[model samples]
Target: MLAGAPSSHMSSSVSTSQGIFPTSRIGSGESPNSGASSFTQPIADMNENDETDLLSISWNQDYGCFAAGTSHGFRIYNCEPCKETFRRDLKSGGFKIVEMLFRCNILALVGAVANSHYPPNKVLIWDDHQSRCIGEFTFRSDVRGVKLRRDRIVVVLEHKIYVYNFTDLKLLHQIETLANPRGLCCLSHHSNTFVLACPGLHKGHVRVEHFGLNVTKLINAHDSQIACFTLTLDGLLLATASVKGTLIRIFNTMDGSRLQEVRRGVDRAEINSIALSPNVQWLAASSDRGTVHVFSLRVRVSGEDSLTQPNAFQGPALFHQNSSSSLDPLISPNTGANPNSSLSFMRGVLPKYFSSEWSFAQFHLPEYTHFIVAFGSQNSVIIVGMDGSFYRCSFDQVHGGEVVQQEYVRFLKFENRPK
Candidate 1:
């Protein structure tokens, strides 16, 4: 149910809305006090002058670093305690830098380009140790995404999915299915299964393919095109949002049963992106109208036997329940399930041109927000804006407000400045 915006009680300790550059060290590994997320210090943001469309930002597990891809090319960085500069720039209009993976010092950068000519479909693997391109291979169609598994790298094109050996980068097995799968995510935490999202196809859509084996499960899911999807880290739950701005459906990743459906409005808003929390319980989805809707399934005790059953009912199907009662009035939205729903209605929070935030909010100036990418066990979110700026953010811990309070710091400023 809707509760009055949680007692607008702002803790004066870490809350600040005035500084051009603010710094705070949060208690790491989940705060015991307010449940707030702590982050590292805000450093310099990677700046670019061109219209840099952010494709993807991924963490390198092997070297414990991070990398990002934009419209023109891709850059690799070492993001340990401090953010390091880009090791090298692989200059190519690698259309949506789909995925970035690091093994030891080797970083495999893969993305899809819409351009028909000039190396139409290819995967580029760069050796970060040598700081040079090691291998580049062409695919059949535009490569949509590439998942780096322990033993294999799964590549998704327009109509086919290829699993290749990670060491040699050689194609092992190829699977063909529907035409244009919009989004692809590896479901298994151990990297065994993958969830393929193909929006707006006819009956029996949405493929759940078990990697290394030839078994595939297809379900007739969603009314319109499946725009975006993400799986829990344990591969227990799968959330799929529609492109038609209706509702997001969460399903059982194992048996393909419809678990819960979160009904969204049928407005012009499109489900742009969806992200699952590191704990694999809560879900955050953003729309084309620039609102971030967060949902979580709370399991209640229905009966005694319900707990032990193997086919346990997940939970009730609640639609777009707002939890902004804990946000400050200054940033909260006025609609949704909360009285202080103003935060979800803010225009620039979900930028039309771009998405991302940096260390400091440019006061008085308009912001172009675009993409928000998150990482790590704690889900450190980096908001990337259209103007080529990115911000690092952690949600407030203690309060439940109508809006999401972002203690963001300027990280990188991309020049997307026209030449």
Candidate 2:
């Protein structure tokens, strides 16, 4: 699994290794507020930064600073007012994956297109203040992803995972898996620490590792290949999707028991991402099909702790009837079983109840069908596209149905300079 806690939650210095990026300071510290009601920006005056394209973006929950990866390098932006306080560009080319360490200057960057200094097969641990890579780790194949916690660093290769100590860069542990090009992994910094989830040796199975306990469990999650997954903030709950994309399953991480499942849709689709809210009360997901669904989650509890209730939560759960009803000419009646769909050719008709599990709320944007999703200020959902555009939408808690949204914030056009 990837890192769960945010960089904003951390202090200025990550570890004794080096200082934080000081050249890119923004007054006291004001990134965009995740709890803001909405951002009313003057888009007409906004201008794109030097970087031409944004390949990846991630937030440091500990620092409230976000790094946007571009062909040149990456820039650090403060969230509240959303300003570009620091910028780092790769003279060689574009960076594919950018993983931020908790509030530390150290960051893991992989997947380079043009830059030779940082190769695609190597993970570069960069110290922002020094503007130099202090350490590097090599892999036999292309590195798919990298993750950082306060104490350790995780790198994901095509089929292998390597864990290293934060200060020494020592190889702590390594895992082998089936073909995992997406670098699907999640880490939970919850009540415990370093709980990880990734694809197992068998397809659709999830290997959950509690690093603190040195224990591992593989859950028979789905029959199809796992698409994407995420853990609750505390690492107690797990949410996963199969290539099928219609169903999203939640499990109790402690015992690998099914907690609950939500439907993304009745038809088959390619899931881009699945995220549980900070509160774990809501789940947001996006698919290449151009739909973002936010479903209300009900986690039953005995007292202060959420209990793991199996089988009782089973059966088709409906978030909504397909928003694009079959009766509507504009809506494709048969999306789940298209012969061209990724897993559509599998035998047998999908259960009629499949249509019942739909997204309670859907973001209808044809252009941003493939965008990445996150929860933002005031529990609003943040949608960012590959083209460098992002939008923030406020979901009504008491009254929820069709998703209500505003125009994209157009991050490329906006710039928050340090004073």
Candidate 3:
């Protein structure tokens, strides 16, 4: 039987007129208290030269919100209602990366190279409640990315990742990886299962660290460099895509076994982001080809059962045993089964293309811009583009075809500079 696709009800359009702070203090650098307020300066009214350039965007631990680092400062937005929660315009400089710790006032910030006050080689731990950086970690090299949990902060450098204790900023551990210019790394947010995934020492390999179990497993995910990958909330499953960008593979993180594979397309493209549904029953991928593909996942990771078991965190048996047997028959409800070529039954007789599993549903965007995708409430997929476009689209889990665009908002609009 096909597991039910998760669903969420989101507003179809975001109201630009609504603001989280007083208009007079929009960019005044004053910290506004949390409460109701009027709309401030809309991006549309800002002068072309004064417009803040978007440097980076990332979703919080849960997909409930996302942070946007800009040339001037950083802002946070709520996902469901699609509203700007708050923003800080710092005079010191702009941030190249802004990572939020859930919905709290704490954020991990990396500055753009142009800013002298906040350099590229340092990570600032900002506490909005205090409106100042409480801690900072300076590195010898430019930081690539930052991941934050309540108890720890993981800073990704070009070839080394540093794990630090969140409270005292003490160095806890370090992992050497391949030359990872992108600073690719992911951490599980669940308290019971502390897992981390990053590129292995060798090309096309992934190093999985189960902190709770004190175990580390290496999986050779692909033949090409890993372009993008995402882990489930509990870190029980991993989905990886290589630079080839045509195929995506799902794996059981505990045993380093491939669970299922889904094809994005035959042509090569850069995969920007891969997101797995909270329930682990669906997967989504976005690419430079301007397409977002949703695939129904066949394997299930029993994350819930592990939470209730007494022996859950015992040695290497932390993960539920059901994960290995979760790969049920491919038969789905309305769709009957995952889409495959008619010659799929002739497996060995034909090429791999005929036997490959393709995406169940797809959504297209403008090919020129880069967009990242994440699964949202109620079977909807949330897409954020580099050009300041935000989209929320829903898909049919059973039929698997075109996704319906329910909401679209240009959260950041820049006027064309005078030539």
What is candidate 2's lDDT per residue for 1-419, written digit by digit as tens?
12222145221111233432343332223333342312111222224553266677775643245677777666666554456655554446767787775455567777576766667887777755454556666655777888777677788877877777775665667688889998988776433356888889999999998777677888888999999998765555778999998889888666677866677777798888776665455788988888788877665321112212221111111122233111111222212211123333442565534334455567865633457777755567777666556666766665556677754565664235321
Candidate that beats the other on lDDT, 1 or 3, i.e. the better one: 3
Indicate the TM-score of model 1.
0.61
- Order of the predicted models by lDDT, top scorer first: 3, 2, 1
**Candidate number of the best lDDT:** 3
lDDT accuracy of residue 403 in candidate 3: 93
Candidate maximizing TM-score: 3
TM-score, each model?
0.61, 0.74, 0.84
Lowest summed-lDDT stretch of 10 residues in model 2?
310-319
Cα deviation at 66, candidate 1, in Å, is: 5.5
lDDT of 3 by residue, 1-419 (tens): 11111124311111111111111212234444543222122342221234778899899877878888888788888787677767766666689999988777678889998776889988877665544456667667898999998788899998888887665565677798999998899998777778999999998999999888788999999999988888877787889999999999988887888989989999999999999876566789999999999988777544434453322112112335455324222333433245998899999898888899998899999885778898777668999998888999998877888999999977777668421
Model 3 CA deviation exceeding 4 Å by range: 1-50, 303-336, 417-419
With a 3 Å backbone cut-off (N, CA, C), the pairs that clash in candidate 3 are 7-377, 7-378, 7-379, 8-377, 8-378
Encode model 1's per-residue lDDT on 378-399: one tens digit a residue.
4344333343334444443223
